[model samples]
Target: MRHNRTQHRSRRGTRSITAASATVLAVVAATAAVQSNAFGTEEEPTAVSQSPTEAQAQDCGAGTFQAQVAKAGDTWKARHGDTVLYTGDDMFAAMNAGLDSLTPNRTTKERMVVLGSGTISASERLKLPSYTVLDVCGTINATGAVATDTGPIFSRDTTDVEVQHAKITGAPMYGMFFRSVSNLTLGQIDMRLSGGLGIRIDNGSKATPATNTRIDDVYVSGASSHAVETAGLDGVTIGTVTARDVGEAGLLLNTTTHAEVGTVDAQNVGTGTGYAAFRMANRNGRIGDGYENNIHVNQVIARGGGRGIFCVSESGGAVIDRVDIADTGNNAILVENCYNVTIAAEGGTVSGAGGIRIAARDEFANTSDVTLENLTVTDSFIKESPCAENTVIKNVELVNTTKDVC
Candidate 1:
């Protein structure tokens, strides 16, 4: 199957503005100029109330068009290939009603442009071929954004779209969901104050998943669970995706996926009783080959989360052979129920989140084949457990440094 690619553009044309009188016309014309800066919309920004003074629709370039707004309850829909650009502050005034009135039909090629502060309803399902882009010039404030039901930017099957610099917040469910969508690219995505998992790359099943995309400069916060999850996303390139103030692991990835995580900082991620910072499960086939699938490199900084970095059970073939963890709230690197996981230290303190009660230790996954190469110790762990069997402490160094574990 191929995606029907369509584009929307704006053109120049002149139309007469309705006038109450020449005097009233002058006033509205002035108002329209100010509105062009406010919401008259040279290009849609946010929604503005209907004006009795001016009764002329602004020109929406060629393929480009402005959504017709009703008093407050009225809705206008878009046909296939029609692109709606917004420039309003209220979500209700932005895209929902305009999108809801659209006649549902087969996937043809339509795109919804998110301008400023807008809200998308849970019941407002944007169907296929109808790609949505979160395009905001300055800041897309979703601080009060809300989705009542299973609110998501995507559902069912979505293919081909680009979302940039839009803050997605206040959803009863996942912020942006990729169900069975294939071949989509999400860049500069921000998930703030969401009730569900921030962003889900869930294929909904183990059989089929989302593939081919670059997720970069994405930040997620205030999720009940994992901030960024890739349950079934395959062949995807991820960069600078960080989750703060989360309830679970910052990033969760599983299956035959390839990813490069740069600087993962999860503060208050776990809810005092949860999983690892970076947890990759599902024993990828070809243990050794799949082991290659294990998170290759990462700079995980976790403080106040249940477990720092965890790999378990069937998530074999992948190895935590070498990771640099620092200032952890609990166990730095906890490996359990899996194989080929190793711990190599770097930096001043490793998963050593300056906490008094913190175990201040790195745990080796038990009941599985795992090893640590060139593990180091500082004056902090002098009073802790000793190294033996699968563990080795080499060239331990800790002096002028303040590692409380000792």
Candidate 2:
């Protein structure tokens, strides 16, 4: 069905501030700016009393609108306040109408687009650009050949974006693709299945890396590629991510800086010939010059996969605190060409052909300051260290190890 597309634009004119009033206005403006930057719209507002200044700041602009799709109408009827904006069969048309009605004043006022629970089957990518908050609680399903052109939910060049309680299923490419975004938060993301990565965050060659990203409680199953892949991002934190039957690594970080993961559980990842449950890599087998650094994983549990955790090509400053592996196809943890790293399987058990292997492929490149501590290995073995002098082991119990430790 064909429909008319609507566009929303908030074009409130700005007024110049006088020098005499600038002092008083600056104080009030600073307080409002703090509220706007604190994920203010993402959370529910407080019920306590607010001062007049706070109230005015919170209501930054007037003429805000909200639209909801009709439940049983063939045409997607969207209404703003009490007026009907449009009635059309196109889901994007209705969504765009709602977004266009709001004036872009960057205020803490009520600016939103509430998606209907009905499944939206789009032939092309639905773009949400420059939206302060995108609370998608509905399902967006793709209906086309799998390609790298776009995704079910693609957002770019946005800031302070929040994606909450959303599901993107059966996308040809990435379920959700975000690029050049900052101060982003994603929670309760459910990607039932996707042809490519479940979620991908990258620079998209925009030269502006995505930064300050937070992902919580994400689950992906039957992903043809990595469940979550991030590259060229700074300051990312992930929590409670689980992937099942992924073709490549469940989570892959390439050229990322200052990343922290709370917990990740991958099952049957690395379905392809070369991959891992969790893979971290930098460029050119070097660090400290436009390379990835400062990655920490608190807990990792992998079952039946290629090396549970693989660090390659100058991935350094990494600290993995706890790891549990059972019958993985390859080494449970493999570190090649990495430095200043520490992996501790404290209070955990590893059962596989190879427990932990640290090697430097290039004879000239040396792996230094690597430590493995408090690990209990059973029916497995760690490879002889490539840099015997720099590898340190503490409180480790080995059973049936084929190679001797340094």
Best by lDDT: 2
Question: Residues 237-264, candidate 2, lDDT per residue (tens digit)?
Answer: 7876798988888888887766767778
User: Over the stretch 1-406, how does candidate 1's per-residue lDDT look in tens digits?
Assistant: 1111111110100011111122323433443343333222224333345331122222111123233332223332222235543333445444454555444552433334433344555444333233433333222223334454244455556665444334666643666666666655554566786567777776776576566544655688888877877766655555555778788778777664444444566777774654666766664312233233324433566666666676654453333323444555555655544444444434324435332111112342232334444444332232222222233334445443343321
Q: lDDT value for candidate 1?
A: 0.47
TM-score of each: 0.62, 0.77
Q: Which stretches of candidate 2 lie over 4 Å from their true place?
A: 1-70, 73-75, 105-123, 206-208, 283-293
Worst 10 residues of 2 by lDDT: 8-17
Ten consecutive residues with minimal summed lDDT in candidate 1?
A: 8-17
